[model samples]
Target: MVTILFFGQLKERLDTSRLPLELVDGSKCLDSVAELRIFLQTKGDVWKENLAYGSALVAVNQQMATEDTPIKDSDEIAFFPPVTGG
Candidate 1:
């Protein structure tokens, strides 16, 4: 299973702060960050735009990671809007 955490607008949009997903063959994994973006796109147009434009940031196991970051079972993934609190 993969633990997905949502923050800020993403959390409000998904109506939840966290979700646990079963890792299936085609499911989002460490090496498939793009796939995860696609999955989020399916949630709505806002997600599609945000993911496509890189408006959000993704983290794996508390470290920032690119879309190509490899994922594994029991991994923890978090998503948050681009930081603007400077």
Candidate 2:
């Protein structure tokens, strides 16, 4: 199982803060962040827009990750809008 954390507008759009996904054997190797976006899109348009947009950021195991990062079972992935703070 993979734990996906949603934040900010993403959470609001998805209507949930967290999502748990079960991965089959072939699904374990996620090569790009774009793939994750597509997976979330399966839920509906709201998830697709919020996550697939250019404004959102991705993290793996609490550290920022790019699309090429590999994903494994039990990995913690987080998605959120870009942060702006003074």
Candidate 3:
């Protein structure tokens, strides 16, 4: 299982702060951030919009991650809306 976290407006927007996910058997060997987003998108239209590519920032095991980032069981993945400073 993987631990997925949502932060900032993303959490409010998705109405969830965290989730535990089990990878499907066949896809376990090569699961990635992109695939995770796609899976989450199935949750609802809110998730589909909020987790869309380039809509939020992602991290794996607390380090910045890209779509190709590999995901493993027990790993922590976080999603946060992009921040800007004035």
Candidate 4:
């Protein structure tokens, strides 16, 4: 199983603050950030738009991650809008 979290405006847009995912059966194969995004997009159009490549910032287990970053069961993934500096 894995945990996904949303933050900031992304939380509002998605109408969710967290999700617990099970990587079993057909989903057990997910192993990278890009793969995860693709899977999540299947949830709906909102997921597709908000989580599109490079659209949101990501962190895996509290550390910054890239598309190729490897993931596994029990990992925690977070998504949020890009931060802007004033």
Model 4, range 1-86, lDDT digits (tens) per residue? Answer: 89999999889989999999876657358889998899999999999999998789899999999999998899999999998899
Q: Output the lDDT of residue 51, model 4.
A: 95
Candidate 1, residue 22: how far the Cα is off, in Å: 1.6
- 1-86: candidate 1 lDDT, tens digit per residue: 88989899988876788988766756434346667767767778866775564778999899998988877788899988988875
Q: What lDDT, from 0 to 1, does candidate 2 have? A: 0.80
Best by lDDT: 4
Score residue 16 of candidate 2 by CA lDDT.
91
lDDT of each: 0.78, 0.80, 0.90, 0.91
lDDT of 2 at 20: 88
Better of 2 and 4 by TM-score: 4
TM-score, model 1 to reference: 0.79
Question: What local lDDT does model 2 show for residue 2?
Answer: 87
Per-residue CA lDDT of model 2 for 1-86, tens digit only, reads: 78999999888878999988765547454445667777778778777777775768999999999877777788999999999899
Error of 3 at 31 (Å): 0.4
Top TM-score prediction, candidate number: 4
lDDT of 3 by residue, 1-86 (tens): 88999999998998889998887756454399999898899889999999999899999999999999999889999999988999
Worst 10 residues of 4 by lDDT: 21-30
Candidate 2 runs further than 4 Å off: 25-32
Candidate 3: which stretches are off by over 4 Å?
A: 25-30
Off by over 4 Å in 4: none
